[model samples]
Target: MTASTLDAPSAGPADTTKVKRAAIASFLGSMLEYYDFYIYASASALVFGKVFFSKADPAMGTLLALATFGVAYIARPVGAVLLGHVGDRVGRKRVMLLTLVLMGMSTFLIGCLPTYAAVGVFAPALLVVLRVLQGISAAGEQSGANTLTLEHAPFGRRAFFTSWTLTGTQAGFILATVVFLAVAGLPDQTLLSWGWRVPFWCSLIVVALAYIVRRRIDEPEVFQAEQQTRQVAKLPVVELFRTHAADVSRVLLCAFIAVCSTVFSVFGLAFATSHEVGLSKTTMLLVAVSANVLALVTQPTLAVLADRIGRRPVFITGVLGCAVMIFVYFKAIMSGNVPLIFLAALVLIGFCYSAPNAVWPSFYAEMFDTRVRFSGIAIGTQIGFAAAGFAPTIAWTLIGNSRTNWLPVAAMVAVCCAISALSAATARETYRVPLTELGKRH
Candidate 1:
């Protein structure tokens, strides 16, 4: 069927099936894209230190490995500006397809690159190049998907549907972690030589699948109407800053809440397993997988609650919960009880984090006019996400030989989470706004 045909209202029962199909398309696409992106993160922490930095001291090697992971974030804001403009000007569906191809190709190439032993410093140099491409591709993926899904959803259920976009992120992280677990057991020679490449290569399969699903989607009704009205901005980024600066700042501030997710998932994992604390890698990986699975369940449900209540209260409760639970989570990890560690990780990442996770899709999109929504969310979140991307390196700098030094690291996470809460507090309650009138002057 043509894109215009797919835009027609269904003859019977509103074809809940089409809406569902749309959700699955967004969900699977996000899962595949994030799986490719996060495999690098998981591998950087667990595998790259050994494979790409074999010659350096383990601590320094791990730091360098993590820094390489952060290098991708450097490109994120740039990608957000560029792709956000295209998405806003051209259409969301087109940019979604472009991001999938870019991410898939970059990830596949990473698998085929030479290792440190064979190419010396060039191995890491090539890795950094591919990572930057991955970052740029990712900068647009979630924002585009969230915007697309939210536009397509029935009113009152917008948050519920868009929550799946974040849910797909959880699925991707789970897939990446599971693959790493399997690869971790391989013989060191095989693992360093070729086994580690398997996860990156698998990205090709997912990328192909995402392309088919995305191609099948019509431009959302909201965007199509905007297009027909000739209201699409010629320069979305410029317009976003001029008219929506306050909302953009709100997004950037809320974006800082990402620290808890990154710290728990990446930094906490490394801190628990490294010689400083010496928790088993298997145990830490299990902790991550379990928490993500719980997040997949809770995020959508909490989003449903936000729809029933209001976005701000749900979001505030979540931020406050995360603030308290993170301290407990850290103490749990420090206590060295596996079950308690698992509980803490799951509660912090899976439950508390889900509160903010579920609310932000509607909250961010609601803050902008459709003309600049893509640019606003993409740029704002990318700027905010920058903290998440570099959080590990920053955490390391704050932490030294003294265990007491952890105060600085924990302080950073607390401060970021607090900012996110404050940002959410300042945002207008958008749950009642009509789709057409969103981002209008009060």
Candidate 2:
């Protein structure tokens, strides 16, 4: 059980081709998954209430739609435990394939579901079920992809490569926003009846592309070497909790940094469009798309910086920056100035948020040995992400039914960022930890 005894054979010189392929695969897969995820988010913010909860008051319907969006997070922890087990015990590639298929199917079904006008109460209920499945699939996608890319990357550049997994997420968010913006521009009747489903159905195309890319990706050499040595854990979740409980705790809190994302992307969208603020849906979507497009460029740059400096500083800086910027971003929304909104969103999301978004793949994965990396990250992040999943709904409730109050919501996001930064500060800097030496207790 000692570190030396558990160490697998060195993987030798990293295969540059495989490293590039793995990064591409991880990026595409994450893009596919988040594409499915964010479309639902955009729909919830734009039209799901009218589509699925039309019988309720407008405010109540919107709240319900947003609530269904959060329902997926409820299933993520369960998926993390189950899918993470498969990733660790079976193989990363297999889990990737399974999660991609599951998400695609669920999102497609959501597109096909009847509206409340047609199905009465059944519409929202079915929406919730599909969202839960999407949540489960997403639970494993990023963590598994991150583990795969990191293990394939050349020594000293893991953060740079792993950053692609998140860059793909920004791409997905942009794609989702663009599609929804087009659909949102449709007349209200057509949009409510059918236009909204177009984005959900489009997931099938991305799913096919992701599957083609993912099928070609081999499991990382490190994981294969561990399997050869019979070092793969039989129950990775159990082993992870037993041996790396503190690390798990740290990842959990640090993962709460995601709250900033949900607030910015989801609640902020709702708040900006509310009658109190009256920003156009297209304008808000434009802001999101622009910021995310900028993030796609900035995230990898910051990740490269993390590889040179350390994950902790980059991550903490992002967290603290988000705490302050959440306030600024929302205040700009309240000001109803398009120029100010875009500027605040670009700086807060495109730059500051990109730091942790790019770094966490390596930062959290490096906290565990190869044997439990997937499960450790999956479980910890899913647990923390549950809060992120519900953040919009929580913010909505805190702002009261009118949705005019922005202060409490900003305060909530700031607190989440503060907790995440503090938790990350407690973690040992693992940027320089050798692959074989990671998670080895002294």
For each candidate, the alpha-carbon lDDT, in order, equals 0.86, 0.90
Compose the digit string of candidate 1's lDDT tens values, residues 1-442. 3323332334454445555666787789999999998889888887788888989988778889899988888899999999999999888888889999999999999999988999999999999999999999999999998888877766567788888888988999999889988887888788888998999999999899989988998767778877887888999999999999999999998998888887787778778888878898778988999999999999999999988888999888888788888888888888889999999888888889998998888889889988998999999999999999899888877788653356677778888888899889998887766666678997
For 230-341, candidate 2 gives per-residue lDDT tens digits of: 9999889889989999999999999999999998999889889988779999999999999999999999999999999999999999989999999999889888889999
- CA lDDT for candidate 2: 0.90
User: Which clashing pairs does model 2 show?
Assistant: none
TM-score top scorer: 2
TM-score of each: 0.95, 0.97
Candidate 1 lDDT at 12 equals: 50
Cα-based lDDT at residue 228, candidate 2: 82
What TM-score does structure 2 among the candidates reach?
0.97
Which window of 10 residues has the lowest lDDT sum in candidate 1? Answer: 1-10
* lDDT computed for candidate 1: 0.86
